[model samples]
Target: MSFETIRQVKKFTMTSDERLFALINATRYILDKKIDGSFVECGVWKGGSMMSVAYTLVERQVTKRQLYLFDTFDGMSEPTDKDYDIFGSLAKKLLQKNKKQEKSSIWCYSPLEEVQQNLSQTKYPTENIIYVQGKVEETIPETLPNKIALLRLDTDWYESTKHELVHLFPKLVQGGVLIIDDYGHWQGCRKAVDEYFEQNNISILLNRIDYTGRIGIKV
Candidate 1:
């Protein structure tokens, strides 16, 4: 895969949704420059977006760039009432649904195996893609290598978002793109980013990619 091929994939996957296009373009831009370091997604559900990044990298013939995908493969962890407030009613609905499901039913949460299988179906070489399975706190340290050129955070909760920022942000290469998939869509996520940046005494350079999303490049 070369830069041209990556451009083709972006063109094919283009959507009216500006956030989606920003994601594709971000991945393409990173690969086209042959950026140093690896690519990582702190919260990959079903590997949809990360797969986009991987496919683009492969298409661009990017070598020596590892793609690390991190996830619990299970649903969100337990949340307190305060956390629940940030998540809104969806959390309650999800909890209710979980209680109603049969223990033996396959209607459970996504597993790491399923995500890996999906990636394999892409026919991209397995050599460059690495799967890190576990909770964000436990998995992020292990997933992040020495340097990261592109870091995508899609964990849609307060705890997970904060954990990733604290543990993973320092590893990001200067000028690296940090894409937050749940930024403005979820209140808890928005609060997490705000609090994290505040505590660090650093201000995030937010670029509203769409009504529900934002991305920032590390200075």
Candidate 2:
């Protein structure tokens, strides 16, 4: 599905226009440069962003690179105090926007079965997509590709995000793109990423795709 078609189809969870642009551009970079690696998503909820990558790859006929989906499939691990803080604020805003949402939690709550169902709904071929069902700390380390062309992460909490960066970032090929989906919006996510860079003394520039998303090109 093209971007315009994706816009028209709103059944999937929310992904901002700017975020999609980053995905498309990163996909273009990998395909055009013939980046030798696969695409991976550390946290996929209902397969929205994951399918977006699959759609673009299929559209461009970039079939060699597989797309990996990593998640616990059951909500998140236990939320810490910081996670509670973020969830509390987000819940209030969500309740104000849609009273119906007050009934239950949103994201990461989707089970592995549902994620597979969601992927089956997309036009993209699933043959090149790999689904690893488990927590980031476990699945990411064990399932990392030999090289990563595009690594997009949306894992909401601190531990999960940091685990992903620790295990997978090094596998990112030089010139590969690493996109962080909840960078500016979620404190836990931001702290994990910022701390990783700081601890490593990594100087890769973070280029903003939008208020909520940022990308760094591995060099």
Candidate 3:
């Protein structure tokens, strides 16, 4: 996967290069192990990581699982009371650029159409991919995949992360992988993860995929 193709993702995607590499590596492992169940991503900004998942599946001609891309496409929601401590402080410290609060608040509110275009233009199997556009708290309740093989959580707020973990973790299949993109990158997200796992008594070995990326394979 020299990705003579990485350039395309890098050129247009918003995530850091290291993060992209980590996502691809993790996606490849799912394919290599032939993990059963569908693929899912809670934060699909620009669809970069999601694109890699599509590309890898196509490259391997994997047609059994559908890829679910969930996002508001509108960017990050207002930091919840629980999230205010961290994200609120950060937002207050930084000057909002373009007078856009989403950019400075916690994460970006991306456009659904643009991301759809990126994946469509890249020739991903649009037919098998599902897009859920709305706030995670509202949009995640119904129609979630019955089983998830690789669950990627990228939302940067504690409330958002907490909701995803609460709703999706139970559905994650045994031997499936859970990747947290903000474990080391964002304080609110890290706290939510740590608290949730500890409270739930989930003791899966947490491994660092990179500086900001982490993974836990369900046993």
Candidate closest to the true structure, highest TM-score: 3
* Candidate 1 vs candidate 3, lDDT winner: 3
Clashing pairs in 1: 1-59, 1-61, 2-59
Q: How do the residues 1-219 of candidate 2 rate in per-residue lDDT, one tens digit apiece?
A: 456636632355566877876787788878889888989998776777777676677678766678899987775564444442344464234324443222135434677777788777655677877999887776667777788888998877778888888888989899999999888777778888999999998889889898879998998
The C-alpha stretches of model 1 lying farther than 4 A from their native spots are 1-17, 84-90, 98-108
TM-score of 3: 0.88
Which ranges in model 3 have alpha carbons more than 4 Å from their true place? 81-89, 92-98, 101-107
TM values, all candidates: 0.81, 0.85, 0.88
Candidate 1 C-alpha lDDT tens digits along 20-135: 56766887777666567788887665666666666665666664678898877775565434343333655445556654233322222467777788677556778888888778
Clashing pairs in 3: 73-110, 74-109, 75-108, 75-109
For candidate 1, give the lDDT: 0.69
- In terms of lDDT, the best-performing candidate is 3
Residue range 1-219, candidate 3, lDDT tens digits = 637446767644566677777767777788888778888999887787888777776677775578898898876666644443433456333323334435433456568888888888557667778999988989987869989998999887888899999999899888888989878767788889999999999888878877777888999
> Candidate 3: lDDT of 64?
59
